[model samples]
Target: MSRMIFVNLPVENLDRSKRFYEAIGARNEPKFTNEAAAMMVLSDTISLMLLTKPFYATFTSKRIADAHSSSQVLLCLSCESPAEVDQLVEAASANGGKADPGPKQDIGGMMYGRSFEDPDGHHWEPMWMDPQMAEAGAHPVESATAVSN
Candidate 1:
């Protein structure tokens, strides 16, 4: 079986978050979707499970962090190119989201990333990596967010 990732997040209003995500080209999967939550199809291997506050709380006993006041996560999505990264970030803004002052820029490796905070202030990072540049660097990844020795 192929390993996949389902990034789940809590939203104040399930329907409102659904609309915001749908406007950005994410398809909604209604099979498992309900008033309490919506499944946003990002790709075959990746999906985002958007759950309402109550539904989300069911998964954990810890108090949910207030995204508008503090961040608990940064969702990162990769694009085919830097252009795609920028376009998606712009799309988020068009659909009522906030953008960071500047994006992660690694021109030498042809990699670039930008961040946007959703309506609820959940941070998301849109990014791209150029294969050719990566090859030139002799390493697949260099500017990773975290360093491991």
Candidate 2:
């Protein structure tokens, strides 16, 4: 069987998180959802298990970190192109999310990335890479400038 990744996160409001994720293109898996948790399907192989804070605490004795105040993880998703990254960021902003306070990244003209924070302050990055630039092994700054144009 293929391995799958389930990124479990504690959410202050399960329903609001569900709406935010769905609005940004995640599909809701009703079969795995309940009042205390929601299964947000990012892809066939990746899922986000959004659990209410109380339910999340049951799985671990450690106190849950407030994502708004401190980050525990930076979740990243890849897109087919730079356009898709922009689209996701736009969708996120339109649905109660905001762009990353930091600047966007252009890696050696091979990769591009943008980030946003959800309502619960979970950080997410959507990125894209150019296969040709990687294959050529071009300098990052040089390629980055070329791609930026």
Candidate 3:
């Protein structure tokens, strides 16, 4: 079986978070959803489990970091094209998410990306890369630095 990734996040308002995710194209997987948590499926291999603060606490002994004030991880998703990347960011903004939480990235026309923050401040980046450039082993860091200079 193929391995799947399930990202668990703590949400302040489960219903609001679920709605935000749905607006951004994720569908709720009712099989694993309940009052304290909702399973949002982003793709066949990627899913998000949105849990209430109390429920999330039960899973971890550490204090939950306020995502609105601090960040723990940056989530990224690959897109088919630059337009798609922009579309996702725009959709996020229209649906209560904060857009452009980070600087926009364009690495020598080989890659393009934008970032946004969900209602709870979880950072998300949507990006697209030239397939040919990727196959050629083009280095993003090298191109990004070159573009900045």
Candidate 4:
């Protein structure tokens, strides 16, 4: 079996976080979700667990970082196309999410990306890449001109 990843985040409002994840295309895994936590399935092998701050505290003794004030980690996902990346960013922003002020990334013609901050201030980046260029180990700028149909 392939390895699976479960990214856990502490949320101030479990319901709001679940809605945000669903708005961004994640499906709710009710079997693993409850009032204190929610399981948002991103892909076949990727899932995100949104836990209430108090419940999440049980995992570690360290203090929970205020995501709105400080960035703890950036969650990024690969999209099928540039349009899909934009779509996700748009949806997220329309649904209680904020656009990241960071510069947009367009690595030549090989990669395109944008990011958004969820209501709880968690960062999520959506990106699209040219598979061929990546497989060929092509330089960002050089490959833009080299890759041809």
lDDT score, candidate 2, position 31: 99
TM-score of 3: 0.93
Cα lDDT, all candidates: 0.80, 0.87, 0.92, 0.87
TM-score versus the correct structure, for each prediction: 0.85, 0.88, 0.93, 0.90
lDDT string for model 1 (37-106, tens) is 8899988888889999899999999999998888677788888888888888888888878876345555
Q: Model 3, range 1-149, lDDT digits (tens) per residue?
A: 98999999999999999999999999999999999999999999999999999999999999999988998999999999999999999999999999998988878778888999999999999999899887877565564542321
lDDT of 2 at 79: 93
Give the Å error, residue 142, model 1: 6.2
CA lDDT, candidate 2, residue 144 = 43
For all predictions, the C-alpha RMSD in Å is 4.3, 2.9, 2.0, 4.1
Worst 10 residues of 3 by lDDT: 140-149
What digit string (tens of lDDT, one per residue) describes model 2 on residues 9-98? 999988899999999999999999999999999999999999999999999999899888998888889899999999999999999998
lDDT value, candidate 4, whole model: 0.87
Off by over 4 Å in 2: 133-149
TM-score of 4: 0.90
In model 1, which runs have C-alpha deviations exceeding 4 angstroms? 135-149
Better of 3 and 4 by TM-score: 3
